[model samples]
Target: MRLPTLRRTRTVEPGIVTGTARLDRRTKRLVGRLRPGDIAIIDHVDLDRVAADSLVAVGVAAVLNAKPSVSGRYPNLGPEVLIEAGIPLLDDLGETVFQAVREGANVRIDGNTVLLDGEPVAHGVRQDAETVAKAMADAREGLSVQLEAFAANTMEYLKQERDLLFDGVGVPEVETRIGGRHCLIVVRGYDYKADLDVLRPYIREYKPVLIGVDGGADALVEAGYTPDMIIGDMDSVTDDVLRCGAEVIVHAYPDGRAPGLARVQQLGLSAVTFPAAATSEDLAMLLADEKGASLLVAVGTHATLVEFLDKGRGGMASTFLTRLKVGGKLVDAKGVSRLYRQNISGSSLLLLVLSAVAAMASAVAVSTVGKAYLGVASEWWDNLVFQIGQLLGRLF
Candidate 1:
């Protein structure tokens, strides 16, 4: 049997990066299909950190954005993330690049221009650390406007989902009992893996009910645990995870349209519909709170205002409102990891053990009965060492 060779990205010239182009209008969907050395062509405006991290993780040769990576609406973190990862980013290539370039086409990015077969398909600004920093600074100046917009969106979401937010009117019932239990809601967002790693001790000790939101189910599975329940639009999750015997809940639109429900049904799996004007992350938190979870620990869910805006959705307002509603029971995974750090270091534990052993030895040496037992132990040790020496001598 012959093995296929792996394709590696290479610089064709001094400043030109060459690789296969992987194009997608949706950055999230594109990231799933990306391979190392592929040039990612995405249409994400103000590309967020999570997407950038995914691109970096895939080791893409370069990123070609159809829209401005930093529109200066707010200090979005994605552009900086990509630049810092040493990945070349050609920004604002326009939507025409998508029409001009085909998927898996051999492409080269020479400085700020994207070329196919030595012909230029698109041209844009080449973003570096300095450019990204300047954009981020400019974006920070527009923070107040974004905050006002966020406030308005919050009010709009409150008006639309007041019943669900306040009364838990539409929360779905699930077989996994969350009542009086710690609930860990995982989202495949910022630092999810690190947070999960730190929470291993907590998870083992408390045995929290694991609830994975869409791709978060995959995150949990990747971290070597099965979700108790999976909630989301079902786009990013895998079929294997869906069949992992987890209770699935479809996050639907407020009008009761659950696109995810169709996929679930087709997979021969049953799922409950949760129709609310909220993101899947918000839905998971609300469900946990409604289901009577004693505590809700969130991993990779947006916790800051900048993160909410970075998500580039008006629906993030629902997350803000959701956090307020569940604030009492909710705790961030970072906070838990920090506060729940192992109290003793390895050396400290070893030293304490040695101290205890020394105290026991001193007590044994001082007492007649203990001294007699110690003598017997010493004689047994000597005899064992002599037997080992004799066995080695015979073997040698």
Candidate 2:
């Protein structure tokens, strides 16, 4: 058999870039430790927008991906974004690179070749914006196939998760009360910060039960709110968020094999395990709806087709079903700020200012010292006016 193409070598010269190799299979966890000018090694396929954005924020010198940056599966916007940001992307480097290179080892990348101690250890295809753009253009042709596969997956998901959609069978019982109160389920997704900022008033007024999904817990903590419950696979969540005194519920597969539970146990923390086929966000909504929450507000939830695709989700059936179950009581935070009538109106502000002024005046009126000062000021004002008038008459 003919040898498979190793890499599409490029002639464009990339000057030597030296940095420590920080490797992690999970992009989210790896991004936390990435420092500026470090070479980021990741195994993420179809690199999502969020991960790409995080890597850019970390200012990595170059990215060495063990997997294909663009598989022509879809127009994954990540590789393009990285290339456009002038961060060199080297892709399709064999998985052996991870084994051969140790973490924190100083490595040199000349073009797509990774050198360890001046010895070539791995080779890959150098991706620029032109190449990434071409790949994305080609990937668009496969969109129909992707859509078909998505439909098939969604159908399969619907059959498997019917009980979760209708009866809410897998929702776990928690101490956080949701009955007859508003519930805010925050997911760390599209424009989540802005959404939270917009909902500040609602959060303060209603005191909604805060449920954070994985990284969203950290977002809540950062925003000066303590989450009532933290739910998700514990992979992306930080240890500090775990110890934030929120009740942690680890998500697991239906078979009850919880990968995240081990991490929780390692942290010496107690967590409830909820096993289901749906995503953590779906489970959060189900829990709130089943718990008799009067209203449900969502922040950073991926609602659009592009967003679902950006998440590299094969299908959005779970989200669709979850929305159907909770849509009546659910309100998306994207437009909540526009719809929510502020309790503080212009009239209220004017009234408040008037009330403050009247209170101050009343305090001054009741003080004998204030009366004496006012009298003195009044006499001074009259004397100044008379002096000015006499001077003006003399001049005339």
Model 2, residue 274: distance off in Å is 1.4
The sequence of per-residue lDDT tens digits that candidate 2 reaches over residues 163-198 is: 877887777788887899999999877667778988
**What TM-score, computed on C-alpha atoms, does each candidate reach?**
0.89, 0.82
Model 2 per-residue lDDT at 242: 89
For candidate 2, the lDDT comes to 0.83
- Stretches off by above 4 angstroms in model 2 are 1-14, 334-376, 379-396
Q: For model 1, how does the per-residue alpha-carbon lDDT over 1-396 read when each residue is reduced to its tens digit? A: 011135478887866999999999998888878888889999999999999988888888899999999999999999988888888999999977999999999998898888989899899999999999999999999999999999999999999999999999989878998899999999999988888998898899999999999999999999999999999999989899999999999999989999999999999999999999899999999999998999999999998999999999999999989989999999888555556556788999999999999999899899999989989999999999999999999999
RMSD of each: 4.5, 7.8
Worst 10 residues of 2 by lDDT: 1-10
TM-score of 1: 0.89
Off by over 4 Å in 1: 1-7, 335-353, 356-396
| Residue pairs with clashing backbones, model 2 | none
Backbone clash pairs in model 2 (N, Cα, C under 3 Å; residues 3+ apart or in different chains), count:
0
> Where does candidate 1 clash, by residue pair?
none
